[model samples]
Target: MKKDNKLKLNLQAILTDLLIWIYILGCVSFLVNHWFEKIIQTNFVVIFGVAAGFISFILGLSIGRKIFLPTIKTEGKWYKTFWGWSVFLLLLITFIVGWNLVEVDLYKLFAKFQNAGGIMKGIFNPNMDIFMQCLAALAETIYLALLATAFAIPLAFFLSFFAARNLMPQTFLGNTVYIIVRTIATIFRSIEAIVWAIIFSVWVGIGPFAGMLALMIHSIASLTKLYSEQIENINPGPVEAIKATGANTIQTWIFAVVPQIISPFLAFTIYRWDINVRMATIVGFVGGGGIGLLLLQQQQMLRWQNVGIIIWMIAIVVWIMDMVSAKVRGKLQEM
Candidate 1:
């Protein structure tokens, strides 16, 4: 009885697929009979495209039906289902549409490689004359990241208490404040570092200060969410014990929560500094005044040698920070 049902389903699907292809062919024949000459003048590209599209559609439908449409009689639920296949087909169709809209041509990408290679070769011979200036710009970038992280860490620490759900009841006032703080942090985080830099640049006139402001605001939003989550997940025993000892809310937090989180908080702050250092370079492109500003200027002026030196410097700094941060985090975790 199960075999009979499975056979019937497969037969029905094949018949449905045959009819769809027949209908497509009929439409193509009708078009060809009327507009053969006009299509011929444009060459066979259009006809080939239509035919290839139909062939691909039929092929995809056949393959997808076999995989997604479950025919197996199982004792338990099957992973392959009709609805799952339908969603898969819908996503496939969307991808095809997007690919066409983008007009991605690989030929253009290949064509540019020669010129790109020639420019890259020039970068091998870096101009050492600008090394001092580049070093200063790189130093400024590091300073910006350091300043931003310092400013944001303290602010994030305070805001996290208000954001932690475990600390606050779901009462009207508590819930309202939680929602507002969470929403604002989300909104701030959604705005990219570069966009923030642009806004601050306009407000304060372009400099490292603008970059610092951008990184600081973004860090606050990110660290608040991170710290709040840590607070929420801390050991409940200590919190309860502290409260039982007649400790007030602030006292409970300081004695119980703060001790648990201090190590992780320090680790998180160091990681953020590492991230900010990288971001400072990028934000500088929008007149935020870091090494990126210098790099961008060199690139625009066609000074690939200078740009190469700056690139190497940035790479070295990032590598060193990554190593240092890993060591610091490891030590913190051990503690």
Candidate 2:
């Protein structure tokens, strides 16, 4: 039986190695064909290339398994192992392909550096005339983020218990509800606030309201995930103790779960608010409203100095929000 088990393990390892070699051969063949087709231009060359690649891979794998692999195993250096080298080569190939696909040109950046001088100058010397206007816009941005966070908190707080694995009942109905809620949250979270902003902008006819809706939707999804994960990690002892008293599902959560997660929940909410404020500026670029719209206008009109002022205002507001959120989260952690 032990010999049979050893043979099974050896077969599995060989199968895995074969599959990996086939995958590598396929990728390399595709790349070689793509790059050389334009230059070589013949079926004979393509066929020969593939055949050569297959033979080379088989030979290398056999030789490596016999000699190189054992040498690397003795060396105890991961970088010298076949798998490590494979990963490094894969990353190198990906980088090379990606660089070509993107048409990266460092020369153009340096050549056009002088074109940005005027804009840079304007940014450095901000137009103070529009300071009040930008401040008002910045205020709108802050409030938009605040309202979104406030609205999402209660809904997320309610949904979290259902989404949490530990809190959900072990029955079929409870499992279904858990899955549905978690799937919906994941779908909503996967869609960025910017995309939601675009959709809402069209529906709501473009403004801070659209931005607010976008931020709120994203916040609800994000907070639900955070809140549920926190619930899952809570001390099971309190939960089991509460269940021992013949409490129902809801009571078990309220008495045992809520108390533990409140601090972390508050902290997560505050941190999310900070994120929303930064995102609000981006949402505005899509006409979701706030200082971003004003900044966009100035930029399009080449009013770099005005754009500079808006940028500074955004920077100041974001910095302040960051500091406040950090302090709030710190306090909550202490509690």
Candidate 3:
């Protein structure tokens, strides 16, 4: 009989195994094809980059891991621990390389703000007319965020049921559905609200409608992730009891998971809406259409008082949201 060790070859499939390989292969081939032009760039990054230093530090861990790597004779705890570290190191290296390749300009980002010194001053100065105007726009932003949460809450609820391992149709079909929903959430979340707004603006014409849709999509994606995790963590007792009582899947979920998690879910939704309002400012910076749009315009026109009003408007809105969420969350926890 063959002796089977606990650590057999890892056969688990990643979400994008083939796609990852293809992209990695493509990048390598592309670099090789343009080697004459790319050699300097690649060498500079690999030889002197912080990412390279981090990579080397991690590569050095192999020496320690080798001693820990379980041989057929050594199925020790240290070996398993080292093995997990190796996987983490691999992921860290990948993230560093990808981040470096993005070529972010931290200096230029700061410089943009520095150029608006006068606008910054005006943002501090109080003005009644502009202040009232900003209030109206901010109200719109809040409304957009609230509406998005409303849509996302119900949508995410349904998706989470499909995503929950206990609540899924069956193991294989349930897992497949879970993955699909997870993928959709990931893709939507990956696309910034500004980008979504831009796409919608093109499709539906620019206004609060475009902004509302963008917030809605992003909110759904984000809330789904949280909702799924919460659903998965819920107690199985009520669910099992409900099932035993001949309750259908939907009924079981409603009676069991909903009762246990609704408070936390509502708290999270309120908190997310507050965050979305903050994000709405940035989204409007790129024509998502909120008080941020007015802020941008005022800064450009050097209307410092108007900028001041916008800042105050944002500050007030955010402060109110903070207090509201805190109060609601406290009450929910008590319940």
Candidate 4:
């Protein structure tokens, strides 16, 4: 029985090795034919290449089967079936197709570095003439994000209770309301804030207000999902205890659930605000009015000096916000 099982394994291994060798040989032959057909025009070169490749493949297979394959064993279920190899081949094909479709070229990327010195010179010697103007635009971006998040927090707080299944009454109407609220939130979240900005820019005729509205809408959807998940994960003990005390629904939430999730809710809200701040810079590209608008205009006009200043300003503001948010979240966690 042992001998029969070992023979079967050896046969399967040989078959797998033969398939891999055929695939590799085909790929190498195609490349060699395309690149060296003129350099080695003689039929002798083609025959010699094929002979060399076959010898190499045979040596590699012998070493792999005798020395390496026996030493390596995977006990996982994936290794026991063909599914793992199928998935790997699928990924390999996807990568090959995507590579050709994208026309990825490292040579082009390398060539662009030749012009980098001039850009760097302009960046280092930034134009200060429009300093105040750019600063005001930056300020407006921060204000817009803050205002949007402020408005979103309260609305999300209210909606999260409805969206959370644990908080719902378990009745048909309660389940229906949960599904509807969750679906709406998912739809809103699916559309990026930048797209929202473009739509609102058209609706409100562009400005900081348009950007604010866009941020607010996205923030509401995102925050509701976060808050609901947080509420759902809260300790159920307090909730049960509150119910046993004959506390009403709203009272139960206030006394039982709110205490546990408030810290995380604040943490998520702060993180969202940080994200909105970064997004606010981009929304301005669609005439949603902020530092990004100035940055875009400078870049289009080839005013690299001014563009450099804008970049630095954005980086500085983002760094500050990141620090502030990290500290706030740390404090919240402590509470």
Order of candidates by lDDT, top first? 2, 4, 1, 3
Error of 4 at 171 (Å): 1.6
* TM-scores for candidates 1 onward, in order: 0.76, 0.81, 0.71, 0.76
| lDDT (10s digit) by residue, model 4, range 1-335 | 97787777666555554444445444444446655753434454445544543454354433224323464444456544333443455457556645655778988889878677766876898888888998999999999999999999999999999999899988999999999999999999999999999999999988899999999999999999999999999989999999999999899999999999999999999999999999999999987789988888888898889988888889999999999999999999999
lDDT of 3 by residue, 1-335 (tens): 12232222111121122233333344443445454444334443333433433343354433222333324243456446533455465466566555556756788788788677776667666667765677778888888777877888889877777766666766777779978988888999999888998898788876677788888899888888888788888888888898999988778877988998898888888888988888888777777777877888887887787778788878888998899988998998899
Ranking by TM-score: 2, 1, 4, 3
Tell me the lDDT of model 4 at 204: 94
Clashes of 2: 0
State the lDDT of candidate 1 residue by residue for 1-335, as single tens digits. Answer: 98887777766655554443444444444445445633333334445544644454355544224443445332322235433454455456556545555777888888878878645865787788998999999999999999999999989999999899988878999998988888999899899999999999999989999999999999999999999999999999999999999999999999999999999999999999999999999999998898989988998998888888898899999999999999999999999
Error of 2 at 119 (Å): 2.1
Between candidates 2 and 3, the TM-score winner: 2
**Model 3 regions more than 4 Å off:** 1-117
lDDT of 2 by residue, 104-133 (tens): 899988899989987898889999999889
Poorest 10 consecutive residues by lDDT, candidate 2: 63-72
Give the TM-score (vs. native) of candidate 3. Answer: 0.71
